[model samples]
Target chain A: MMAFIHHFTKTYLMWNEGPMIWTSDVLILLTSIGILAALTYFKKWKWLWTEWLTTVDHKKIGIMYLIAALLMMFRGGTDAELLRTQLIQPGMKLLTAEHYDQIFTTHGTIMILFMAMPFIFALFNIAVPLQIGARDVAYPYLNAISLWLFFFAAMLFNISFVFGGSPDAGWVSYPPLSELGFDPGVGENYYLLALQITGIGSIATGINFIVTILKMRAPGMTLMRMPLFTWATLSASIIIIFAFPALTVALALLLLDRTIGTHFFTIAHGGDPMMFINLFWIWGHPEVYIVILPSFGVFSEVVATFAKKRIFGYTSMVVSLMLIVIISFFVWGHHFFTMGTGANVNAFFAFATMLIAIPTGVKVFNWLFTMYRGRIRLALPMLWTIAFVPTFAIGGATGVMLAVAPADYQYHNSYFLIAHFHQVLIGGTVFGLIAGMYYWWPKMFGFKLDERLGRWAFWFFNIGFYICFMPQYALGLMGMQRRMFTYPANMGWNTLNLISTIGAYLMGIGFLFIVLQIAYSIRYGERDLTGDPWDGRTLEWSLPSPAPHYNFAVIPTVESRDAWWEMKKQNRTDEWKVKEDEIEPILMPKSSGRPFMFGVAFFVFGFGMVFHWFIIALVGILVVFGILAHRAFEYDDEYVIPVDEIKHVEVGLGRL
Target chain B: MTTQTNHTGEAVHVKHSAKQYIIGYILSLVLTAIAFVLALGHAMSFKPLIIILMILAAFQILVQLFFFMHINESDGPPYHAIGLGLALLFAFAFALMSIWIMSFGYHAQLVS
Candidate 1:
């Protein structure tokens, strides 16, 4: 019993790590306590439970996802600042090499998996149903499950900082390095288990959105007539469903290798690490498209709206989007062109990678054409969209440069590679998501974010982005290898690295301005009394801002592409108003605590697995299955909002 | 309660009889048993036996799709068919690419 206790304390507690961990533990503890105290003091637990946690409403789920994404961005951004600060000067001791490894790993993982994925999902939940003119997602309860699983998985991953330790074998967790022979700690286990849980959630979300978009569009809203964002969501969902399984298989096998001594990726026993790389990139390459495609969707919507014109070549845009999706799967080998896959294999992948540039270039031209010879409004969202085009163009051009297999040998693992990705990811995905948040802010809330503050945030972030990453390209060309904790001053990387670090801080400041913008807007921003704030063209704008929980009292019949715009043009906006006699009871999925409980159970199972506590893991699995069985057998899972109540809500919202 | 509104405003009340399920179950079982028996009996050389097993597996997949998954029934666009086609295409592509890529790694003598 003593030995068991000692083992548990040593492996799981991780109390003796250092001051950095101790500070994190204290901060996390205090934050939790403060949040609990505030919730109690406000007497809002019941409100929280009924309105947010147990909600099967897609809007509320989207809001929750948005909040989580923003918080994760703050976390990920902080990690970036720390990394930059560490490399601000040669041999800076702000962080030890060991700590730097963990931070960079978490930074990449959190930014991509937690930040980008949730940001996109939040947009998916918030906009897809609304844009498609549906009341809710096709599987609302399953949607709730997906959200909770992601939340809990994120919590599980973050807690590794205070508990077992963060995964330090980079975000990819490539094998041989990630194998038990080298990394015997529980950190890699945390990475695997957390990713596995979230991966399942992501897959369910993909399936849900596919079904929702495919089947739930309003009458006459054909596939081609659907909003570009919805189309993007559909394409991204397809990619998600196809791509995420590869990640699942890769992570699961690595876990098996860690826990059960498998030879799948082990070094000595006929295990091939290259297979892991191949499988990971098979998912990984398409995964970038999955995130960025949605941003492309956002840009299309924003450009069309601000340009006061229909999107230029809408069909071509969609064809190109699908082309990118198909091509994404074939180019995973470009990620490891230098891994000695032979000339023929490398040339094929390189060619496929470059082929992506054609569709992407077409999209850039389409956006430009959308804005050409049209009245352009410079709304905050539009500003981000306009910024994205030139930024992503340069990023895409650099990406093509890196796609050359022979040249990749020079740029591989260098600051140039890092700069290229951060360019596309931040310049592309982050910028687009931020634009989406601003575009839909009034739709989610009833008020617009403060424009002046948003502009400040935008310029700082955008300028800081160029200042930060542009130098890294030069640094990469100067032969600075990535993942290095520090450098010698004689290497002449000091000036560029210093400038990059400064730019990172500026971006951090910009992020702060955004938070301030949001906070100030909540109290003093302009109210969006009219739903069509931007003179938007999509079906979502047809409904009132902060639309009632039932969304549309009567589902609007879509007549053409840009259905709402068409309705407005025809002066038929009153079609949303329904007579008292026309009101019908609406069936909505019931609020249940099951998803949250299931997330908790999965968390327990994951945590137990991380620690190799078989008994605890078994109990968790049993509880998980028990909940599933209960859910399956239970038939009464939905409730109806009576006609009278919906009428009352419509009257209150002045939609009667 | 028995009828649900589909995408096209029609109420789709899909009902399946236990007989169909039993038939599907029996067919799946027989297919599996035949594959097992052939393998266990070593009834033919490796190449032919593998080819026959592959054929049986394909048939089993079709049976499952038609019987259990109800691939043909739809109220709107054939999303299920499109999804299935895409899935099969991706699966085949992934398998072929993995083999092609891994073969190169083997040729290069990168991994054991």
Candidate 2:
């Protein structure tokens, strides 16, 4: 008992790490305390628990996802600034090499997995069901479960920094180096388990959205008539369904190798580590498209709305979206072109990788044609969309350049490669998400964000992005590798490195401005009295701003592509208003605390696994199964909002 | 109430008897047993054995899809069929490509 306790204290507690960890611990403790105290003082605990935590309403769930995603973005952006600061000057002792490794690893993992994934999901939850004219997602309870799983998994991954250690195996967590032989810490264990838990949520989300889209559209909203964003969500969900299992297998096998002393990806005992790389990239490549495709959808919506035109080449846009999805699967080999899978394999992948650019180019032109000869509003969403064109074009061009397998030998693992991906991911995905957020913010909160502040934030982030990443291409050509903690002054890399650091700080400042914008807008921004802000085209815009729970008292029958726009054009805006006799009781899934408890159980299980505490882990697993059994046997999961209540709400919204 | 009509007002509920489920369950178990016996007993050469196992697996998937998943019971278009077909295609591609890529590593002696 004493020996076990000693081992646990020495390894898991990690009380004597350093000042950085101690500072993080203190900050976490104080911040948590402050939140709890504030909630208590404000007497808002029940409200928080009932409305925010337990509610299965998709809009409230979406808002929670948005809040969580923005926080994760802040965390990830801080990691990026720290990395740039460490690399700013030669021989700078700001961060140790180990710390640098951990930061970069966490930065990549957190930004992609926690930040971008949830942000897209936020858009999905907020927009897809509304646009399709559904009261809620097909499985509202399952949707809540997905959110809680993601939340708990993110917490599990985040707390690793101060508790034990952060993963240092890069975001991919490739084996051999990631194997227990080399990395014996619990950091990789946290990475594996946390990702596995979150991956369950992601897969559930994929299945949920697929069913919701395919099965729950309003009458007359045919497949081709669906909004571009809904189509994008469908495509992304398909990719998630196909791609995440590979990740699950990869992470699971790696976890087994770590915990149970398997040889799946280890060096000895006939284990093949290269297989791990293959599996990782198979999912990794499609994972990029999964994120960017939604942004593509967002840009399509924003451009059409701001330009006051129907989207150009709608058929081709959809064809290109699916083509991108299909081609994304075949091009995983491009990530490891220099690893020498032979000439034939490399050539095939290079061709496939370059082929993706054609469809992507088609999309770019489609967006351009959407705006061509049309009135452009230059709203905050439109501004971001405008900036994305040139930036993503450059990123895509460089991507094709890197696809040439022979040329990749030179650019492999260099800053140039880093520059290319960041350009696409940030300029494409992040920019698109921000545009969508701006476009939907009024619908979400019933108040528009300050346009002036949004533009300020936009310019700072956009210009800073170019300044930060464009120079890195030159640095890559100059033979500066990524993940390098420091280099000597004589390499001619100092100037560009310092410039990149400055640009990164600018982005940090831009993020702060966004925080300021949101805060200032809450009290001062324009209220969306007319739901059709921006004269929007989709069905969501036809509903009230911040649509009441049980979203549409009577779901509109979609008639044409851009159903709401067609309604507006025909002067049928008041069609949704109904008489008291027309009102019907609405069925909604009842709120339950089971999903929250499930997440807590998952967190405990993950935590126990990370520390190798079998008893705690066993207890957690038992409770998880207990919850599942309870949910399965319990059939009274829904309730009806009576006709009177529906009428009252409609009258309150002045629609009756 | 558990099988309420959707927004499209289609009868989404597909009735199945316990007899059908029993048949499916027995068939699945038998197929699994055959695969297990073939593998354990070395009933054939390696290539032919793998082929037979693959065929069995395919049959198993069909059983699961038709009997369990109710793929043919939809009132609308055969979206379930299309989705299942796509899923099978992707799964096959994933397995085949993994083998193709990893075989090169084996030839290069990188696996050792």
C-alpha DockQ of every model: 0.41, 0.43
Query: Which residue runs does candidate 1 get wrong by more than 4 Å?
Result: A1-11, B1-8, B40-43, B105-112
| Candidate 2 C-alpha lDDT tens digits along A1-656 | 99888776566656666778778878999999999999999999999999989988889999989999999999999999999999999999989998898999999999999999999999999999999988888888889999999999999999999878889989988888899888888899999999999999999999989988987888889999999999999999999999999999998898988999889987679889998999999899999999999999999999999999999999999999988878888999999887767877889899999899999999999999999998999999999999999999999999998999999999999999999999999999999999999999999999999998988899899888988998999999999998999999999999999999999998988889899999999999989988878899999998889999988888777888988888889999877656677667777889999999999999999999998988999988998999999999987888888998888887888777
Clashing pairs in 2: none
Candidate 1 per-residue C-alpha lDDT over B1-112 given as tens digits, one digit per residue, 9 for 90 to 100: 2111432365375889999889999999999999999999999999999999999999999889989998878876788998998999899999998998888757656653
Q: What lDDT is reached at residue A217 by model 1?
A: 77
Q: Please give, as one word, the docking class of candidate 1.
A: acceptable
For candidate 1, write residues A1-656 as lDDT tens digits.
99888886566666666677778878988999999999999999999999998998999999999999999999999999999999998989999898899999999999999999999999999999999878889889889999999999999999998888889999999998999988888889989999999999999999999988887777888899989999899999999999999999999999999998888997699989989999999999999999999999999999999999999999999999899888999999999988887887899999999999998899889999999998999999999999998889889988999999999999899999999999899989999999999999999998999999999999999999999999999999999999999999899999999999999999999999999999999999999998889999997887788978878777778889988888888998877567788777887778999999999999999989998988888988899999999999978877788998998888887778
Q: Where does model 2 exceed 4 Å of error?
A: A1-10, B1-7, B105-112
List A-chain TM-scores for all predictions.
0.98, 0.98
**Candidate 1 clash pair list:** none
